[model samples]
Target chain A: MSQRVPVHVEVNGRGYDREVEPRRTLADFLREDLGLKGTHVACEHGFCGNCNVLLDGAAIRSCLMFAVQAGGRSVETVESLAGSDGELDELQLAFTEHHALQCGFCTPAMLLTAKQFLRENPGVTDARRIREAINGVICRCTGYQQIVAAIAAVAQAQQTAHSIRIETAPPVRVAQDTR
Target chain B: MLAGGQSLVQLLKFRRCRPSALVDINGIPGLDAIERRDGELHVGALVRQQALLDDPQVAESWPLLREAAGFVGYPETRRRGTLAGSLAFAAPWAELTAAAVALDAQLDICSAAGQRSLAAREFFRGPGETALGDGELIVAVRFPAPAPGTGAAFHEVSVRHRDYAQVAAAAQVSPDGHGELVLLCVAPTPHRVDVSEALTRDDAIADLLGRLDPLDDVEASASYRQRVAPVLARRALRDAAERAHRRAPA
Candidate 1:
């Protein structure tokens, strides 16, 4: 048997310390070790982005990283999307309202991937860019049309909110008018 | 040992390779920098593909690296895959290998014996193979600055967007119309061809294509690569030439 290594990681805002086999994947560690089953694993390889999770705010394929490699890093999984009261976030609600998922096996990863996309590209509603952003996560269901729509809807809402905030800002007095 | 385990971890899961001990190099300091020294860009071993693509200096100067990096896997994979890791993996279809060869990048290797430098062209022996001997690790890669008024472009055709290229071409052209072309997925290693005159001569292009022994795997047939390679080479060369002319000083 291979020796187990000590791994300390922050997942979903909680710290967990465990001793696991050095070869264990982060996907397996999250599901089996921590019972955070929200992060699903389909293709053990990196081909399918089904195992994507946020490592320090950037989306990464958990299956491609060893559990020990995640030591001292912060990982955000699908479980972090909803609040403690089970209240869904804006992106999650958009997914449901737009019917972005069907079989739901790829939903968790898709959400995380989209979350990173939205964070990197603020208020970008371009369908082509959105498709490119989530291109890693292969969805056998939903045809990706709804998923693109859901992300675009959120971006559009954010853009409108930003404009409203800018318009409502206090006006600056001109020196010439004061004189 | 691993920098980015995007490929190594998958191999482990498949039981293709088993090392008694696994070394994680992600915590190593100073190995993740993308620095500019003298006239070359020195990319450390742990610099991620996405980080290289996002570097403004890379996009402004070494556009070929940026373009090729944009074709590697996807955002998530690029976030975890390192440039040195890609070169060390030496996958035949890896875009960075083609870019490195085309740009004449030099790799900095080190081991207990000491340090040495190897040109990118001499690094690859075959698929999943490199000139790196036992205990040798690639510390960084030095990509020389493109000549003044030089521009580059990378083009490839994959089964899907961001998939492994069936055949890809990377080209860089100077204002004088002299340049190099590197072809990927058309040989066991990234193949460099003389594009200084081949771009204008059909016979020269055909001669270069006739020498390639592309793989006959499931992704694409060898015949298809033979048919598509020249077209990609021409497109990349034309685009690069146009950009080079635009950047040329009056």
Candidate 2:
């Protein structure tokens, strides 16, 4: 038996300090140890995106990263994407409204990836770019058109909201300097 | 152990691999750098494919390498897979080997004994095998200063956009503006076809074709890969030449 190593991690807005084997993967830790089953495990390999999670705001394959490796880091799963009041976020709502999921095997990873992709590529409302960004995750149940639609819907809404914010906010005059 | 696991993990799920233990090297610092020193380029072993493609230095300086990195897989796999892992592992059929061979790159390997450097010609021994002995780790790879006015290109045929290459070829034209050719994936290892003598003959293609013994395999027949090898080689040579000419200082 491998020796149990102590690990401190922040998951889904909660801090966890526990002892686990050095060999325990972060995916297994999230699902089995903490009981945050939102992060699915499929294929066990990195090929399937079911084990995808955000490690310090970057999407990565959790199975390939060991739990001990995630020590002293903030790890976010699909569960954190929910609203603070426990309601679905706009992307989750868009997914449901568009019927973007069927078996839901790849939903958590897909949602997490799509969430980060949209935030980074703000105002890139093109359907082709959305497909290219989410191409990292693998989905066999849905044909992927509806998922793309959900992401597009969210991007369009964010753009509109940003425009409104710009229009409503107070503006300050700036002085130009000639050097 | 290589932590990227793009190819190794797939083999594990299929029960084709079962290593006694895996040493995670992803956390190891200073192994993912892309450095340029004294006109030579060095890419660290753990440098990810995505990072390699995104670096402007790599893109502008080594366009052929950039294109090869983009063809590895989708964004996710590229985010973790390393250049040294692919070269050290070789992974049966790989396009990077062909590119490295065409570019005359050097492999910097470090083991308990010491550090040694081997040219790509000597590093790649055969399919799915390399010159690296047990307990040794690939530290970095170095590319020689490209000849002035030389260009290079990499081409492969695959079923899907991201699938492994069925038959990949990389070629570079000489800087002297004379016709010179280097062929990859033409043998068990990436072998260069010596076309110097043949190029001086009337039918250069015919002379080169007569001296080939391409092996048959599951991905592609030896003869078929052999036949298409020169076609892609010719195209790569032309493309690389054009790129070199465009970048050469007047």
> Highest TM-score among the candidates is held by which one?
1
Regions more than 4 Å wrong, model 1: A172-179, B202-204
lDDT of 2: 0.77
What is the C-alpha lDDT profile of model 1 across B75-145, one tens digit per residue? 89988889999999999899999999999999999999999999999999998899999888899999999
lDDT of each: 0.90, 0.77
Please name the candidate that would achieve the greatest DockQ relative to the true structure. Answer: 1
- Measured against the true chain A, the candidates' chain A TM-scores are 0.93, 0.94
Looking at model 1, give its docking quality level.
Answer: high
- Decoy 2 TM-score against native: 0.86
